[model samples]
Target: MNTFGMWRLARKYDKFPTPEEKPYSPFNRQEPQEVFDGTQVYSWAAGTAEFAHRGAVLLRPLPEDPAPGRWLGYKDTVRGPALDWHTDLGVIRLVHCGDSKAATDVASAITSNGNKDGVVTVCALYGDMGFHGPALVAADTAHPGIEYEASWGDVAALVGQVLPWWPDLLRLPSVIREWKPDAQAAVVEVPANDNEKILCRAAANDVFDVTSRVAATDMANSIRNNQVDHTSHEIEIFCKDGYSETPNQVVAGAVPDTSHHPLPCDGDREALKAGWHKLALHTHPDAVAALEVAVGREPNLLPFGAVTEIPVRPGTISDRWTQRLTMCDPTAAHAVLAQDDKAEAFFIGPLTDMPVLRTPGDDGKQVWRFYAPLSLPAGGPELASVVLHHTLWVITSDGHVHPAPCTPTEHLWWGDGWGDRASEAAAVVDQLLDDLGATVDLHEHWNAPKGLTALFNEEHKKGAELTRAALLHARMTPPRTR
Candidate 1:
């Protein structure tokens, strides 16, 4: 029963259930539609299912020790413990009341039932099959008393043992999941194009802490009762769509106060009017200006400049190695397209900060120039390819562009093919940690602090992947010269 309830609640929100509980779920059943069909047997099968569905949002990870003096009574014939989850109040149970007479019947049935002693029940009373709202009746069967609360007459509660826990179940997280676009709304359209972009920080089923949920309920009640004129909180929203909080103002860039993106060129201006394309705007002001001009004119153009800050700082590279590395300083002014005849065919910059850009030659055909980052003593990996939308392009110091012969995942994990090379990867990262005076050796201490291990591992793995991809792109690709 505990396993079944886990499946039922987890199914409400699209979170994966544990491996052990997966097979027992109705989702795996041959006829799941029949099992989920809205019938009295289905909802009241274990009696806890209805309230479990009702208070599903209030579920939390089960504490090591549940509070003493409470038990959940399942429906007749159903067995085992309650769901392996808890609420702030205690374990959850359910009591069903169909009408005024059924409330007394439910109380009598619960008190008479030997298994229901000291059980914390959530009573769900419905006036009729059609009438959904039920009056709040908090009852404690062990004490053999019941209290009727008139304020929440439309609310539901458990029979004979419910009042204490019913309120906590109603305290759902007050996150706004949907907002219809309105001319007068504070925030307008969520800006997104064909390309996948993160629109909001909050997810649809984000869970809040108990305190926040209680505050949300209070705030919601206040607004519903006409206690406040406006919303309790003011939220600042950023969107690319030309809608503003104030009339006649269309603020742009990352924040509302930031200046607008540069005006698009003649060709790009028409493209903008046509519709939003798969483009990521550059963060640097000059890069944004250049991207605006190149938007519609250039084919397969990647936006120049840093889109986001690199997570890790650049490692110390020798003076001679710096010269060998192209655009080692991300702040260096690099052009996407050169009007003069004497510019390099391509610009390959730091994998962390800048993107590799290719330009068309005199033959009116595109050519790529690749530059690989210096190899360390470990010979860990080299820059090989640039992967975009599953298409891999090999980048090399050979001053040419070609299609990568392998997939990005295969390229990154190619070293793993020669037996277990994870220890080698760990050793490579340990040297990086050693540079910072840290005495950590990932190869030796398997149980090192997570943060310390992650600090070196994540950067090393990411850098290694980029290097491998770039190297593959540079070496294996066949140049298609016009």
Candidate 2:
């Protein structure tokens, strides 16, 4: 019989004002009774009549006046549908009573709503009376939507559950940078070579290789000079010197150690002299001296015999058999050597033996050297020729090559990996090849022993009919005049 009991008693009648309505005081009453429809229906009764210090009780009017003779018994206040059990109003009304027993009874009555209907009710029981201040109690029940069913601890947990989407609800700035198409637009300028402009103009697309254009210019120059003519009587060499069956051939007379030094019996001396002159003009004197030592001769002396005919490309002698050799362009020497069938097994070898007399160190130290030919094949009687010398020896007890090693040109492109600039050059080559209607598979030859020939054979076998059809189409089409 407290505030909550009074509220329950007030809510029982259909004529009672909703809990949402404001309370009104009766003319004679000290405490206010909530009113509806201008009727003074609800009232508080002193609970001292029922139990001491229990505060006041509440009563509701009976539906019909009490039956004539029989004494009318009052029933406990019945909850109504208008009372939201999930809300804190019912709980607030119950727990605000002055007496602990009354508050406990009110809490029991609210919780009992679960049995009457599906609604579950709960109440906060403060341990200390001081904590049950009016403001604190009102604050707990202030929000209309949330019901104060349980203790503060449970309320905190409920708040956390209700606020689950709070973090997701907040606005966040984008982490990724927004790039506009126009902002990214830029012009890349390529440095020009001799024929770069011409190639770029002739290119079907805007893209062209500046370096390849230079190389093509050199090639065109060579063609003009009759150096690389298909009709030229160029000697092709197939050599097999038995040191080890390595990929690159070992140069004769290049090792300082004279063990298996090949003499300058043929055109080797002139070739050696030419290679030295070529190298001396471009390289440092110390490097030239190193080259001479590798060739088993002084820098001043020539190594080839006068009677032997010196071909631009030196032939290899395996068991006294000689053949013609085809020379590689100086700029493309490394690429040519790397792709050569004979130069695949071992990483080290001499490019040309005739022009350079290279030797291993006298003390059995490993050394290799290159000599620029005295007369370049392009300018001289020889169309194209140069010698490469390789020297191999055992390492000293300290695991170092003796007689000091010779450094090759830094500009030579021999290694597998290239920097950004070289990669761009290779890409240009690929693009040019594509435009020329050529399917250039450089890696296939690089990986296999038979090289490009083997790849061509494989492709021919696999796509013979397709290739024939392409050929037929080519024959039927008229050549376009530019």
Residue 453 lDDT (model 2): 19
Cα TM-score per model:
0.19, 0.13
Error of 1 at 134 (Å): 20
Candidate 2 residues 376-480, lDDT tens each?
Answer: 111112101111111111112222221111112111111133321222112212222223212223332223222211222221321122122332333245334
Q: Evaluate model 1: give its TM-score.
A: 0.19
Candidate 1, residue 428: how far the Cα is off, in Å = 25
Write one digit per residue (lDDT tens) for candidate 1, span 31-96: 332223222222232235345443221121233443432333234312111111123344333333
- Candidate 2: C-alpha RMSD to true structure equals 37.7
Model 1: ten consecutive residues of lowest lDDT:
196-205
Each model's Cα RMSD:
23.4, 37.7
